[model samples]
Every structure is written in C-alpha cells, then in structure tokens.
Target: MDLCLKLGLLLVIYTAVNASDISVYIPQIAQKITTNVTDRSFVLVQPNCIFTQYPTTNVWVVVALNKSFSTISDSALSTPIPYSSYRNGLYNYYHTLLVSAGKYPCLPSDSTSNKVIQIGSETCKGNQFCNGVLSNNQTYRAKFILLNSSGIFDTTKWSNEIILQQGKSFQGNTGLPSGRSGGMIVLTSILSVLMAFLLLSVIAALIFGGRDLCWKRTMLNQKHSDRNMDFMPRSTYRSRYDNMYLVS
Candidate 1:
C-alpha cells in the first residue's frame, strides 16, 4: 500500500513539472521588405511566435506609426480589453487594425507559426477604415498581443518594438535615390557608351597607320626605278663614233 502511494505522488509531481515547463514565447516581427507586384509597390510584414505546451487560441497584431515605446506601453496598459472585442477604441488610440489567429489560422501545437501581412499604398486612405499608408523613407514599429478565446491578454507575453522602414521608391514617390532596377539601368548605359567610343578609336588608328605605311613604300619604289633608268646602256652607235675620232 505504501509503495502505491509513493508511485502516485511521483507521477503527480512529474505532471506538474511538465505543465509548468510549457510557455508561450514572445512574437518576433521580421524586417519589412519592399516588393513590386503588377507595377505597384507593397511592403510585406511577417510576424512569428511559438508555443511549447499550450495551444494558441488567438493572436492580435497591430502596427503603430510615429509613436514612441513609452506611448505604446501606456496605451497597452490602459486598454485591458482585447482587440477582438473592442476595435473602435483601438482604431482611435492605435494606428492600424488587429489581425487575429482565426483570420491567419495556425496550428497551436506547432513549434512556430509565421503569418504575413501586406501593406500597400492604398491601404491607408486617410479615412476611418485604416490608418494612412506608411510614409516613404520613414521608420515604423509593430506590436503583437496574444490572447485566449475568453479575451484574456497575456501581459507577460508580448513583442518588443520591431522597427522597419519604407524606401523612397515606394508608392511612386520618386523623390528619393535610385532603386535596384534604376541604378542598374544607369550603370549599363554608361558602360555601353564607353565601349563604343573605345572601339571607334581603335578602328581609326589602324586605318591611318596603314595609309602612312603605303605612302612610304610608294616613294621608295619610285626612287629605285629612276636609278635603274639612269644606269641603262647607251646606244652602240654613239660609242663607236667616239672610238673612231680617237683613232684619227
């Protein structure tokens, strides 16, 4: 009987330790990358998190612009209500809408889940629907709040400030420096012009050198022909007449 009791106690202790070991990790937001789709520019935002023991029921993510960390902390503390249940207040206080787990759909038992959110030039219309689009060459930050089905927020599990920026080329704003495509085009054009100029210079040099060599050869041939004419034999009659005069 005593052995049975000891074994049962050990089992309970092991279960408790295992359950405590399971913890939900804070979400990490990836750096924003700009991409062109159908002649339009867009920013891709991907945030990821992991669960060891517990299954994730819901996730609330938001992107705030031009706000400091202290301000975000204050707002987060002030609003104990989950974003799913309360949205109007969230829009008023925060910058953007909340993305829930239901919309994204991730397996709770999975070690990690990465969800993508796309921000386009038209996303921000300066209306109540969404916060205005992100500015070009401007820095922004994102926040992820995890919760359960009962709208209970895990204050301890939250993301740190994830910073990202948009390039000047985003959304047809060409005021900034050149992008990858533009820079390549400019460089290629310059190289092509230089190559053409070098080829022309080489061809001109060869043509002029050949002409100079031909002129020198023609002059040397003319001089040699004149010398041969001067050395030719005199008429035989003229030579005989001179010998007869000497004999007389």
Candidate 2:
C-alpha cells in the first residue's frame, strides 16, 4: 500500500512540473515597400530581435516573402517560421511570407492557440508606378505592428513597433581628401623623400669633415717619412772621418 501511494504521488508531481513550463508563439507581419518614383517593391532586411521573460530568455527568427508580390495580385500563402526555446538551447526556424503593394491586414486562422505577432516594414515613402485603368501612384509608408493573444500570461504585455528606412550606402573611396589608393602612395612618397634628404645630409657632412681628417693624417705620415730619411746614413759617404757629426 505504501509503494502504491508513493508511485501516485510521483505521478502527480511530474504533471504539476510540466504544467508550469512556458510556451511562446509569435506571429509575423510585414508591410510592402513601394516608391512613387519607381514601381519597385522591397522589404526590410531581418534583424535580431529579443524576447524576455523573468529568468527566461529567447531570440527571434525572422520570416518574409520568398518572391516579390505585385500590387494587382494577392500574396501567395507561404509557411511561417517556427522557432522555439526551452532553456539554453536555441530552436530557430526560417520561413517566408508574401507581401504586395497595398496595405495588408492579417490574422491567424486558429484563434484558440496562444500566439504573438511581429510585423516588418520599411520607412521610406518611395513611389510605385502602376499601369492600370486608374493610376494609384502615391508614396506609401511602411509600418509593422506586433500583437499577442489576450490573457497569455500575467506579465506586462504590449505590441512592439519597428520601422524600416533606406539602408546606408557604401561610399567607396569618395568624399575623402585623398583617393582610396592615393593616400597610401602619398604617405610612402613623403617617407621616401624624407629618407633621401637625411642620407644626402649625412653624405655632405662626411665629405667636408672627412677631407680635413684625411689631409691631416696624410701630412703627419709625410713628416714621419722625412724624419726617417734624414736619420739614415748616406751610401755615397767616402769615409767616417769625412763626416764629423752623427745624424740621429
């Protein structure tokens, strides 16, 4: 009887623990990018997003359209990105959505399931050209709104908004005082000129100062030779009596 009771208690405890595990689902929405000047449509690039729960952390996986959608046609239904996190491990999934030129309103087909929403869009009001019976040529702004199911958790919950704009361009070697490759060349040339000047200065100093040193040494050697010549006895001397004095 005691063993059965213990077994029953263990079963109850396991169920309680699993019930407290947190599950989060987020829905994605996006605004189609359009411009008045050109009929090109674009979308914002996916960026890292963060989700925080007390003592629990999560990362976002972005999803978007696989192909460009037109203004006249409806967006094709695509798959949603599936991402999940239990604790330290990251479960990220990539999916795509279809967006067109006009404003798109979306809601999940299943309302009973708990989920959150994230909308992606751009900021520039670029114009799109439409060759239709009636021209709808106007600059349209992109907007994204995030929504969550009601009564999911007790923590503070609200929709988050993000706007996209024209990304900064890569200004290649332009608008600089020196050109891209020219800067290095100029620096190298300056260094070479300075080195050449230093070498020339050293050579000039050596030419003037070394001449004096060389001349003094040569004159000293010549004087020593003359003294040696004077001390030597002459081979043409007739006899010792002929020369009265000894030369040292």
Candidate 3:
C-alpha cells in the first residue's frame, strides 16, 4: 500500500510536468492570435485641398518607418535641390513626413512634365527609398516600403507584434482504456467499509471463542450413565452372603 501511494504521487507529478502551458496576448488595436499582416493601405492628401478648393503649389511625398522626427540630425538632409517656380521647401522644409498626407498642396501639372516624382538616391535611416511622387489631380500607390533589412516592403515585417500573456496551463483528459474503473476512490471507500466489518468480526470472535458446534466438558458428562458401573460397598456385600449360608 505504501509503495502504491508513492507510485501514484510520482504519476501525478509526472503528469503535471508534462501538461501544456499556453501564452495569450491582447492588442490595443483589433488583432487575432498568431496573425500575419496583409492588405495595408494609406493615402496622402493635402489637408486644405478640398474638392473645389486648391492651395499653393510644389509638394512631395516622403515615407519613413521607426525613425522619430526629433532624432533626425540636420546633416542627413543633403539631397539635391529641385528648382520650382511655385515653392522650393514644403511643410517647413522637412524631407521626411510621418503622416500619410504628402507635402500638401496638390498643384496642377502639364502633360509633358513628369507627374510622378522620385528622389532617385536618398537614404532615410540607412534605407534607400523609391516612392511615387504624385502631382495635382492624381493618386499614386506607395506600396513599396523602404525596409532597412530587406530591399522590398513586406507586411510580415512592418506589422504589429503579438503580445503574449504567459503561464496559462491546462490538464488533459483522453480516451480511457477498457476494464479500468476509478481505482483510488473506489478502493478507499471499500477499505473503509471492510475495516468496519473486520473490527466487528474480530470483537465477536474474542468474546465467543471457537463455536457452539463443538461439545464442552459439561455436555460430555450429561451423555454418560453411572448405572453401567459396580454399585455396592465391599463390606455390606460380604455380610449379606454369610447370612444367606446360615439360613441354608
């Protein structure tokens, strides 16, 4: 019994060690568990440029990632200057704008003029960029992201992280084998009842020896008769014999 209890405790410990541990996460934005990023889109538009209205001309689109505006050093902005009759510097002459809206003011362009612009060779945070430069009355897709590690843009990289809450665990219940009942609980209950019955039986056996079926010393004496033995005293038998002779 002691060995069986030790074995049961060891089995329980082994089961606990082998159990599955899970981690879960909740995002501020709507996201699913173990998901991949896909179908991401963003538009660049002049805030003041409404359907019927227009603003001062000469604006460009600039995209960036993981680079804060404040961290940018002044020496980094050493790109070739393009002379424009309308305006040279845009959005306070900031080359990299974090917002999707391009350097505002969608100005009209001629057919011969290149509607789409490109800063051919410029590096932002060591990443070479090739973005669409849209003119007035036109929209260009900025699908190509300047990833530092990889040459092309990938949602798999720029997508949000899956934050996980750790240490959640569970126990497994599987298909049971045949002819095996609940051993521990059943055996415990049976032991309790059997112990009670065994104690009562022991007490009765101590009080009543073997059984009533065996003959005792007093019972054997009652079964015998004293008439089967010699009944007279010796002296009295002799005197009776002598009187009988004298009379003859």
Query: Using TM-score as the measure, which candidate wins?
Result: 1
Q: What is the lDDT of candidate 1?
A: 0.48
Question: Mind giving the per-residue lDDT tens digits that candidate 3 earns over 25-72?
Answer: 111222221321212212322222111111222222323222233343
- In candidate 1 the C-alpha lDDT for residue 42 amounts to 30
Tell me the spans in candidate 1 whose CA falls farther than 4 Å from its real position: 1-58, 65-67, 74-99, 102-115, 119-132, 147-152, 155-248
Question: Per-prediction count of colliding residue pairs?
Answer: 0, 9, 1
lDDT of 2 at 4: 100
Question: Model 2: what TM-score?
Answer: 0.24
Q: State residue 79's C-alpha deviation in candidate 3, in Å.
A: 55
TM-score, every prediction: 0.35, 0.24, 0.17
Each candidate: RMSD to true structure? 14.0, 18.3, 33.3
lDDT of 2 by residue, 1-248 (tens): 99999999998886545333212222222233232122323233221121212212222223222221112111111222221220112312122232221212232444312222223222213311111111012222221222223211211111122222333332323664422456777888899999999999999999999999999999999999888777767763434435655542
